[model samples]
Target: MGKIKVTQVRSNIKRPQDQKRTLEALGLNGIGQEVEHEATPSILGMVKKVEHLVSVEEA
Candidate 1:
């Protein structure tokens, strides 16, 4: 299976609660934080939820 590298490129502070939670759920705690995860429906959902705050690349 392919994997994805998700990087938090923007700050989540002052954002909606749901967006903040989405970032946390993706294992991103702060800006510049990166997490490697298998490309799956759940992760894709979370990424979509916070697409403005993160950048994703195939890993």
Candidate 2:
């Protein structure tokens, strides 16, 4: 599978608990933090859940 870079671009403050947890699952703890992961179905779904708070790009 291809790899994708996920970068946290927005704060999680005031966000719903699920969204915050989603970000944490992606290993994002702060704005500008970046993590790369395989483009698996589960990872993609997690990204979708918090898409507004992150930026994704091919890696």
On TM-score, the candidate that comes out on top is 2
C-alpha local distance difference test of each model: 0.93, 0.98
Error of 2 at 49 (Å): 0.4
Model 2 lDDT, residue 30, Cα = 100
On the 0 to 100 scale, the lDDT of residue 37 in model 1 is: 97
- Give the top-scoring candidate (lDDT): 2
Q: In model 2, where do residues sit more than 4 Å from their true spots?
A: none
Predicted candidate 1 versus true structure: per-residue lDDT over 5-33, tens digit per residue: 99999999899998988898889998999
* For model 2, the run of ten residues with the poorest summed lDDT: 20-29
Among residues 3 or more apart in sequence or in different chains, the pairs in candidate 1 whose N, CA or C atoms overlap within 3 Å are: none
Give the range where candidate 1 is weakest over 10 consecutive residues by summed lDDT: 17-26
Residue-level error in angstroms, candidate 2, position 19 = 0.4
TM-score of 2: 0.99
